[model samples]
Target: MPRVPKIIPISDLRQDASGVIKRVSASREPLFITQRGRAAAVMVSMKEYEQTQHELEILRLLARGERDIEASVGFNLEAVLADADALLAEQQ
Candidate 1:
């Protein structure tokens, strides 16, 4: 079963901003903020945000590699692997 998302009104958030931040951080899930019954923003823990950014960066790198291949741009596999290893190590 899919989990229902946590949603809250802007007014509620404004009333207890600190509590809302703590809830979102502890839950490690996106907290949907609504204004006037419409989606206004999403809040997430800093750790979650950082992880997402890292994953997106990896995807972007892979996509760029694919584009380079399609364009017939050549790279040394060993050198690329070494660079990738260094990048992954840095993340750890």
Candidate 2:
């Protein structure tokens, strides 16, 4: 079974901002902030946010690669692998 997400009303967040930050960071999970029973904003730790951005960037690159392939653009496999390794090394 899937786990339920952590959620709290805006008021609760307002009352304990630091506590919320700690929980999100510790769990590496997004915190759903609600306003008047509707979802308002999501909060995440800096680490989580950075990791998410990196993953999205990889997805974007893959999508761009597909577009290039359809356009008949060419790239060397070794060059692509080397670039990917360098990019990943920078994140470490």
- Please give the RMSD of candidate 1 to the true structure: 6.3
Pairs that collide in candidate 2 are none
Residues 42-75 of candidate 2: C-alpha lDDT, one tens digit per residue: 9999999999999999999999999999999988
Write candidate 1's Cα lDDT for 1-92 as tens digits. 99999999999999999999999999999999999999999999999999999999999999998999999998889999999999999999
> Which parts of model 1 are misplaced by more than 4 Å?
78-92
RMSD of each: 6.3, 6.9
In angstroms, give how far residue 72 of model 1 lies from its true place.
1.3
After superposition, candidate 2 runs with Cα above 4 Å error: 76-92
The TM-score, computed over Cα atoms with residue i paired to residue i, of candidate 1 is 0.81
